[model samples]
Target chain A: MEGEIRVGIGTDADLVIARAEGRAMAQRLGFRRPDPTLIATAISELARNLVMHVGHGEIIMRPIVEDRRSGVLVIVRDEGPGIADVGAALRLGHASRGGLGLGLPGARRLMDEFEIDSQPGKGTTVTMRKWRLRDDLERLREKRQQRG
Target chain B: MSVAILRKGEYFIASIQSDLSDTEVLALRDDLIERVGRFRALGIVVDVSALDVIDSFAARALRSIALAAKLRGARTVIVGIQPDVAVAIVQFRLNLDPLRTALDLDEALALLELRPERKPADGR
Candidate 1:
């Protein structure tokens, strides 16, 4: 990850905790500080989802940048049962189990871009990207805040 | 990284001094379990006053340590969570569910009102 944060974790939810450490290390190394908070937060939710739904998964964190700037990309993949309702999962106000009612939605909310891939008994891969030091993206984020 | 132990009533307090990273956390988890495995303390309060940041690795290590202590027949409590940090956990929605949180060392110790240390020959 050039300027983005990257991390990998096991299927076990307990092991997924390493995601936070990864973000912190990235921030310490000067990749991005503010975004790591959201990245780590989303990463934790995805990890919990994997443990709760898939039962096993891996999280890979890397940087995503257009030019020579910095950003964070989190990829959470699982191998077990897959989601049956991708649309419902992405709904702004949906939840599984008892989370902030956010997890997937919240993940999408906190990042610059979010994508999910899943199938019936196959698995799921969630790719989320958040960029720091990007002016246009930052302006769009500010506009979102204003709208909120 | 180091853990300083203290005696409060019947519980022993462990004050950690380090970042509590993965390697350090694993060692702390094991050593605390081993030390408290045989002790007959009514409870053990771990003081984290020295730590500035605790991530999932540290939290899991704390959770494992607590569980290991429970298996050893002693209650475990994590004490002294800074308010700012707690806010961060919430603001970022950091998942510390695996680990138990406490207000301070006093409350943690008071939760058990630990009894006096058992004599070495008593074979508790």
Candidate 2:
């Protein structure tokens, strides 16, 4: 929780904040080109989903580490009328709400891992992560730089 | 101002300065559409190099801007999409059909001047 950041998604302005923060965090975690941009785009989609449908939600971002790989984890949650059919929502080009219908599926394609949980009448929670691995030479260079 | 709109000759140029909110994005679209009709411009260029992320909503808004401007008898060319941003857009599989793009503002201006009659293939 030390490195976790939570942003309230109550308005369109909040989406801007979440996207910038996600991109910054990804860059700090050493995510290479395209990954940081991808993460930021994914954050935008999830935050927009809340603003469009539920009108309010929260996005949590934190650095993750596992098995010699470092990554960023993003969790978006909203307390509103949940999805009736998760499958339908994830299906590309199916605009359940007359929008582009690409938010969920597009975010899924941008990240390495994705999971969504929704209960009709309850709420929806989405968790996604993107990882980056440092190769041996890069690790050695980092060690050398640390020594100096 | 998040976006700057300038007039050069017969075209209107709207350059987005930074990341924009949904409301601002829509506002830019509406503003451009109205300007195209009011000015009776021949072409319009939208610069988005400052935007690091172009998600589905932004992407859709762009296409809408192009189509609406076209309806007003003005050609629209999008300029300055960063390389990383382009990659993310492709991965998202966002539909940007009918929206012409140029590497920069100069090319966009040239594109409008080159072919004034029919739609040309996408410019990278």
Which is the leading candidate under DockQ?
A: 2
Tens digit per residue, CA lDDT, model 2, B3-120:
9999999999999998999999999999999998888899999999999999999999999999989888999999999999999999999888999999999999999998665456
List where candidate 2 sits over 4 angstroms from the true fold. Answer: A137-148, B118-124
Q: Residues B11-78, candidate 1, lDDT per residue (tens digit)?
A: 67888875354456677677677777556665777787665544433555677777777777777888
List, residue by residue over A41-114, the lDDT tens digit for candidate 1: 56666776766666666777765545435566678898767778888988755656643345687567667888
- Provide the lowest-lDDT 10-residue window in model 2 chain A: A134-143
* Winner by lDDT: 2
Going through the candidates in order, state the TM-score of chain A alone for each one: 0.72, 0.90
Instruction: Find the 10 residues in a row with the least total lDDT in model 2 chain B.
Output: B115-124
| CAPRI band for model 2 | high
Residue B114's C-alpha lDDT in candidate 1?
50
Q: Predicted candidate 1: interface RMSD?
A: 5.8
Q: Each model's TM-score, in the order given? A: 0.52, 0.92
